[model samples]
Target: MGNLSRLLKESWTLVEEQQDKVAGYFYARMFLSNPELRDLFPTQMDVQRARLLGAIVTAVQTMEDPDRFEEYLQSLGRDHRKFHVEPQHYDLVGNALLEALRTFAGERWNIEYDQAWRDGYAVIAKKMMAGAAADTNPPYWNAEVLAHERRSRDIAVFTCRPFYPLDYRAGQYLSIEVPKYQPRLWRVYSMANAPRPDQTIDFHVRALGAGYVSGALVRRTRPGDLIRLAAPMGSMSPDHSSNRDVVCIAGGTGLAPVKAIVDELSRYNRTRWVHVFFGARDRDDLYDLADLNAMANKYPWLTVVPACSDDPGFDGEQGNISEVIARYGPWNDHDFFVSGSPAMVKATMRTLAGLQVPSIRIKYDAFTDG
Candidate 1:
């Protein structure tokens, strides 16, 4: 490992136990040093602190692979532009980060550790600035909600039309900022349809406990509501060039991107067999079954299977989605896509691996939140 990486990993192990404290200290120091910068962030600091710490940990873990680490940093920088982050802000953040580390390290702090952190932060800042400079598109697109349907008590599907053309492939996600919910607070949602000629996008949102943005999106937002969308990101799109059959496993709202991919396939009249296994807690949770069934009826190449984990009286596939998938497969030769809560995705991936599916044949977005 590189010296900087080693130093960061060592220091991180010590500070991780007090992550909340370190993040609070960092933000407090930053706001104190530059009070003018406080307005850039949301009023709620709890989620913000967790996000900041999580990003740092992810960057540190990716340090061993320079290419991936650089790409990750650049993407992060480009995404931050939507929040009106500027070059000068990077300097302020870097300084605050170093100070927090020093405060936490106390007796463990030394010149070598300080220099290493400085060096690492320099790379991150430089790449992020470069990424910002290279972007030609608008920082964010303003979209108006055209329609909203309450699919269930907890889930809502929204169709929005952006003022400008929002170009994105199937299975990509966009970060949306709803001003009415909490101005400047952004949350990621998968685009639930393939590219439409009218530049209309669809999002499926499920409100979980204390999900401030999601609750507002599901229950408060209505037609004519304006929302800001960041650039489309994620690498979970289908490999169009591959002729192999596909197996998709989706749990809950994880079905969004899978449906998008299926829609795209239908548009192209793809001949390769496509099987989708949709899982939910019970029959009532299968909010999109009608849509899926309609798609299956129209597309000869697509098949939809609904599974329930908790309903004993349900007639369809009964079990966890991963377990049900394992029952149907010798999925060794098929391309696999799994999306769901983190635990579901992880378990599905393990199941696929046990079936001897090649790692390259399995594609998923690991960054999605439940």
Candidate 2:
């Protein structure tokens, strides 16, 4: 690692454990320093605070991959346009971030760390600014809900059509805002199917504890409702260049992106095989099993395995999905796409690592809008 990456990482360790406090200090500093900028954020800062730390962690993690780092930051910049972020806002953010780190790091922080952060933040801001400037698309798209189906008490599947041409890969995720329920609060969900010419997109949402956006989306959203969609961001799409068989591990609503990716694969795949392991806590939670089975039936190259962890009566695979995957594998040669709750994703990734699957062969979608 370069000196700058090393310094930034080592310094971050000091405050990483106290993430909440560091994030608290960050927003406190920003709002105190520039109270006017507070208008750009939602009234509920909990999700925003988590996203702040998540973004930093992502930036730090991707620093080793220059191409990925630049692409992700640029996409983030374009996505942040909906927040009305401007060139001056980046300056304010940098100042607040540095102050937050310095406050949390206490005596452990020093000149070298400070310089490394300044230089790193400068690069990050520059790339984000460039992305924002280069983007010609609108800050957000006007989407009209065309279909809404309740699959369970907490889960709903909804489809929307953007008024504009919403260009996105099948496996990317987009943030949605329902102005009626929560105007400023936005939550992200994966595209549930491949891109189609009709410009329709699907999302599966499971309401979390006290999740305003998710609750509204599941219980209240209906056909003909108007919602806002932000630009799609993520790189966990199909890597067609390799043409290797792929395995998709999905739990609950995480099935959305995996379904989208499989849809994309269906378009051109002839030689490669695809295996989908859909898991939920119980049979009731396997809400999309029928649909996935239908897709598998239609596609000759596809295989669907539904597993339930807590439902003893489930006749198919019936353990943690990762454990089930291990029984089916020796999958070191296959590309891996994983999506689920953070805990589920972590456990699955750990299992894959234990099997000696190359880290480069695995791609996981990790985000919790709830």
Candidate 3:
């Protein structure tokens, strides 16, 4: 397994920088050899290309741990049902992937690397197949946008309800397909609220970069707009059994999952304290502070602290959230859940590390933005 892991990781290092070329080659080969499979994907190949490469990256990441790797592959397989992926398609993709890697890996590629990836992909396909077969849930659900509110120039809050109950944990993230976008194009968002009897989901979207789905969701979606939601996947739920208190940090729309976990904690918590640090660049970006205050007012065990890095007029914690956290007592002993843009999460993690927070005590959704 060690040699296999080394060979896999080494192969990735050789091609990751040239991923665009690799992805282009893989897809071109597939469409050229099996044109029928082209109908299974979206008209715009941009999102599909990134997703395929991302899936391979994820698979390689988990290769070190057999159980974790298998579980991830199975979950991925279960999720891929939404794409109508078949067993035969897996073989098709595997061959294209090998060809792509070999072409880009150049002289560094050897029989050992080829055989390792082949064996690894076989296990990956088998596990994914088993997972898809075991799932009884629909590949996706038709949802109606119940409400849409533009909180800022680039941000929107949407309330949507699936036609059927969408069973998911409080903090899990789900991929949503919008009718306004290309057919079958999907983007992931954290469900901002805990499950209600009504089963409505709240999504907070902010247009970042050239975020295609975020732009569509923020600017174009309207009430009564129909959407599709794929299965939920994440593991950021709170541990109620732990005696330690909890500290949740969030920035921008990353507040979704942290808020859901806190909302979930409200149902089971008795004595544990929960401290929430919500931060943004300016006052307008801290859009959920009022709502968080309302939650804090209702729950005696929860505390919400608002921070603004660029708002000089702000009377609250007027610094980066990571800096504000330092003023509070060292929460190194508390269970930590952090979410936000990848950059914000990275800075916060570095701060937590400096505060002597044990790695095991920290948790965050590393791939929410990916």
Candidate 4:
């Protein structure tokens, strides 16, 4: 690690213990210093606070790999365009962040730490601005909802057509802004199918009490509704170079990206065997069973297993998806794709590790804000 990386990691270790306080301080300082900027953020600040701290932590953690760090910053910079972020705003935010770190650091804050952060922030700002400048596409795309189907009480599947062509790979995700809600509030959702010539995309949304965007999408959105979609982001996708057998595990709405990968595989008529485990709490929660089964039937190389944790009467695998996957065992040779709630993903990762799967063979996009 470089000097700046070491400084950032050391300072972050101190701030992480009081992460909530530091995030609260940073936003408080920002809003207080520039009241007009408050309008650009969400009305509820809790999730936003967590997101800010998480982003900083991730940036620091990845700084050791310059290529990865630059890519992440570029993506973040491009995505921030949707929020109407301007070049001047970066300086203001950086100042507030340094102030927060200083306040939290107390006597521990030194000239070296301050200088290191300034240098680091400069590098971040330059790369982010460069990313924004290089973008040929519009900051955001206007999409009209073409279809909205409530697959279950809490989950809905939406198909939308962008006013302009949206170019993305099979397993990427897009940040969507619903104007009816907080105008600037955005949520990320995985594109649930492979890119098509028509420029239409599918998203599977599950409403959570704290998910304002998801609630609006599942309950208030309808056909003809227009929403804004940011540029596609995420690096989760199949490794086409390797024809190894694939194992996909999804929980709840996490099925979206998994379905997208499978769609791509089916379209290409891939010869590799794919084992998919779809997990739900009950039989009623298996909303996409028919479609998945249909796909499995059409693609003989694909196997779809629906596992229900609470439904004993269901005539299929009975257990949490991760537990069911454990029963199959010996997944050391297969490439694994996992998605769902953080708990589900973490649990499945543990199961995969127990099965001796190499970390490099496991792939998923866990950074998108949901």
As a whole number from 0 to 100, the lDDT of residue 68 in candidate 1 is 74
Candidate 1: clashing pairs of residues:
none
TM-score of 1: 0.93
Q: What is the Cα-based lDDT of residue 78 in candidate 1? A: 73
Clashing pairs in 3: none
CA shift at 37, candidate 1, in angstroms? 1.5
After TM-score superposition, the amount by which residue 77's alpha carbon in candidate 4 deviates from its true location, in angstroms, is: 1.0
| Per-residue accuracy of model 4 over 132-230 as CA lDDT, tens digit each | 888888999999999999999888999999998888887788888899774778888999999988888999998877888888999999899999999
* TM values, all candidates: 0.93, 0.97, 0.95, 0.95
RMSD of each: 2.0, 1.2, 1.7, 1.8
Best by lDDT: 2
Worst 10 residues of 1 by lDDT: 361-370
- Residues 8-53, candidate 1, lDDT per residue (tens digit)? 8888776878888999999999999999888988887767777766
Q: In candidate 2, what are the lDDT values of residues 277-314, reduced to their tens digit? A: 99999988899999999998999899999999999998
Lowest-lDDT window of 10 residues in candidate 2?
48-57
For model 2, name the residue pairs that clash: none
Per-residue lDDT of candidate 3, residues 190-308 (tens digit):
99989999989998888876667778898888999999999887778787679899999998888989999998999889888999999999989987778899999999999999999
C-alpha lDDT of all candidate models, in order: 0.86, 0.90, 0.86, 0.86
Q: Which candidate model has the greater TM-score, 3 or 4?
A: 3
